[model samples]
Target: MTTESSCPRCGAALDEGANFCGHCGLALVAHPSPFPPGVSSLALRERIAELTAERTNTDEVLSPLWALLPLIAVVFGTFIGILLIFTPSVEISLLIFMVGSIVALALLIILNYKLVDRYNKHLVREASLRRTMIEYTWTRGQERGTTDAIYPYVSALESIDRQALMDEQPRSPLWSLAFLIPIVGVVLYFYMLYFLTRFASVHDDRWHAFAYNIHLSSMVNGDMVPPPLPKYPQERSFILYLLLTIIFSPFLFYWYFKLVDDPNKHFQEMGAFEDGFLTATGRALTGL
Candidate 1:
């Protein structure tokens, strides 16, 4: 049975050996390939594999160095102070103790700041990888919708890192001077805390939800950052702190530290699930 072939674009009957539709300008090549030119399954798999390896290396580098360096500083400062305290002469001992304390404190602050800077660089890399994953997903023609879901997380995290620097003297000399003032310093300190808390809350709310399946309390410590997670950005935690402070001084530190310890567990969980973002995106393109 002889039949006429119609143009896919405009339903006009396609004449023999027609290269394109006369009506709507659609190309009708005889030997069309299933995959787009220069875009193949193997190329996508290689890209996905490269991203997975890069992400793995990033996670390895994104360690708990920030958590430990402070404690190291504390130990060093305390050891030096103790040694000076045990010296023989009273007057000379006091002067040496003061000098040593100042030096140790300065070292601690500098070291901690350096560690934080490294961590911030890591956040930039992590953000870039996530952006790549989202973009690659769309590039494969497998998913619909925008790839703008994770940028807020990255920006919010950077905000936390920068805001935390206000606690340092060199980075914020005005703050150092302001703290010398009595009431105003106290107000400024709390304001900073409130701002950071809200920022942390936003990160946990928007990005962490997509990043993790486990709750913070259940999260494994020392696997990455130890718990206590950051300051509980919720108003409830703030009210609880106030209430606890009024009731008993001893328990305040406990709750405060608890609020301060928010270890990030999102990336660790990424490799844990087969349906997780990294795996899912790769599979969508490779079908493996």
Candidate 2:
């Protein structure tokens, strides 16, 4: 003899494995399949998997290439600067260095713009993925005549929006001008460092931000953030090294790479945190 389960909503007898109550039509499952009339489960899974894999591959391939940009810039800039320094005519050296600085500055602007654009695109793609997951979860639950699991995917989308906003804002241009001042430039350099650290430390997952910032701080100090030149004669002597490096555009490029790499870490951290939140929320909402 078959046993019957009472409907949670209507108290009507429900057959085993029945999606809804035969008498009152109350749902039995938490998540009903929401696949459209034509789409198969396997097809949906394949599409999601493919998109996810593509995103992962893109990150893996682009990250290292971005990291290397600074090294390349520094090397090339140094070579050109060195040639200018050793060449017989001081006037020619100065001219060449000026031209080199201009070229480096232009390249930096272009690369920075491109990286930001790409980062925004990634965020958009992730947003779409999160939406798809939410839809699938809800449809599946509803089809089975149950309450839809809602929390995990919704939270994930929120996190993505937050991270995207952070990435979209341009870094302060005022700090760039600080390098022109005499003794103040040194103070400004540290100020910029503090600002960046604070910026990166945001988000619900603090540890991820902290760890990511540590790597970023290292990159900045080691490759991009230069020490302040002294104002007096003794300090002024140190300026020679700065001036020489300035002629080389690559060092600047390396710094740009370092800055760009920070965002990737930020995005990944946000994505993972959001996904976890969504899953937990879904389970809780479904009481499953």
Candidate 3:
């Protein structure tokens, strides 16, 4: 039952102890290894574990600091907002309020930009790593000369790049200017909140969503830059102002947290899921 082995490069019998095909002079040792058809379960599990560990390590290094940033902005903004509310004259109050608001807004904008930048960079790194892993797996599989057992993990890296580009740019001035209308302003504020949350979800960066919500809340409350004072002194009654903020502040904070934590949740349902996946992930990664 002896069968002759033919040279891969030329149809000639391979002789015993021959390093090359006698007829074609092609090296026999240059042939690829005939390994198993597919990746072993043990090796697959090991790779999964390694990837998970790397993700965990990266989260540990980045999450806590990011989570604390929004909280800090809220506390500082609240203190300044209260102080501006108590200032004696409308002019003085407006001046102090504008100063505080500008500082808070700038802080929020800078922090948000930095966070988004870092997130995009992380995505690029992950995409590159995944590509290399896929190529290596493919090469190994090809060498074994099996066509049936391909496990492709190729991701659309271009989609990640496009999303990152969309996130970095500011909304058009036409849209931002629409915030000047009283009724339209409220609508635009909520719209922006929705946009940021959706953006964060696509990037898998929930902390950015939460932070943007808080920042938007601060912006809407006029904590970033105060609005102009009422022309009439009677319209600036302290009692009326206090009543407005007290009645509206809690509800506003509630909505902001709802959008950031779980955009699907209503105001009342928000508290129930405050400590859910997004919050836990943010806390775990940022050490917040």
Candidate 4:
């Protein structure tokens, strides 16, 4: 959605509701509201409530599977020990222990991956709803029913976030095989950790969440000018949360999903989405 700004191709004002510049014929982004723009506050509340419910249901289905992680690790570990002891080559029990644990962990990952894939469509829709609402907030205005106040910073911020979600999608634990080699594996593991925290930190700052102490500034790794409305919480040391996630993933998992479904809470409270994107092009400079 663009405001009636001069076209980049040919400094011409676009006609109201027209997606292309009248004089230049350059195509503009035209985002129609997924939910009708004008209605009673009650209508907005109703749609918001529905989205919240959908996210809640996805969480419900995921809860028990997560709860089973510890049990699965323990049972699988113990069963491998006993079975290996009875083998003709009992001397290789130690090797079996390491291999067994990795295999067992991989099985759990596959199970969760299937579950996540099942609900992914819903997550995408939820993300789209969040994006649409944020975009709509910037565009909606009285003169032409929408504003053309589009800025490069806004576009860059949104692109980073949307791509971040897709990048954070559940990949097969087999990818951890990169860890088998010495130096390469170490690099891959840290790279994976960086990706995980980067996405998590963005959500934490964006939604004004308190569930985790993620380091937003460092993790974003982009130039940031503090946007006014987001009022981001002070970020923590990157090493701290990354260590916490590695050592105690169950709690982090809960917080991760909690942050995922939190857009509704902010949307409900703020009424209109104020751009929370931290960009160097914004007011105050940080990490430019």
What are the per-residue Cα lDDT tens digits for candidate 2 across 8-121? 767776677887678776545544233455553234434545555556533332464655544555566887788886889888888888877766654544454455445445
Tens digits of per-residue lDDT for model 3 on 1-288?
A: 324888887789887767777787776664332334366423532453354345433222332344444456677789887887677788988887787777765555544444344334444444443333333334433444421223211122223334555564544334433344587775674455445445333433422333233223223322221222111111122344335546776443433332333322221122222223223323332455
What is the alpha-carbon lDDT of model 2 when measured against the actual structure?
0.46
Off by over 4 Å in 2: 1-47, 53-60, 63-65, 71-82, 88-95, 106-114, 148-288
Candidate 3, pairs of clashing residues: 63-285, 63-286, 64-285, 64-286, 64-287, 64-288, 65-286, 101-224
Tell me the TM-score of model 3: 0.37
Candidate 3 regions off by >4 Å? 1-65, 68-75, 85-95, 151-288
State how far residue 61 of model 4 sits from its true place (Å): 6.4
- Among all windows of 10 consecutive residues in model 4, the one with the lowest summed lDDT is 210-219
Q: Tell me the lDDT of model 2 at 183.
A: 89
Q: At residue 267, what lDDT does model 3 achieve?
A: 16
Per-residue lDDT of candidate 4, residues 1-288 (tens digit):
556668777888766677677786665765443345565323333444455555444433333345355457667888998888787775687788878889776754554444444334444544644554334333322113322332332344465556647654644445435445677876765554444334334544644321111113212322231333453323434576567777996554543443333333333322222222222212222233
Give the C-alpha miss distance for residue 252 in model 3, angstroms. Answer: 8.0
Worst 10-residue lDDT window, candidate 3:
226-235
Cα-based TM-score, every candidate: 0.44, 0.42, 0.37, 0.40
How many pairs of residues collide in each model?
A: 5, 17, 8, 5
What is the clash count of model 2?
17
> What's the C-alpha lDDT at position 155 in model 2?
40
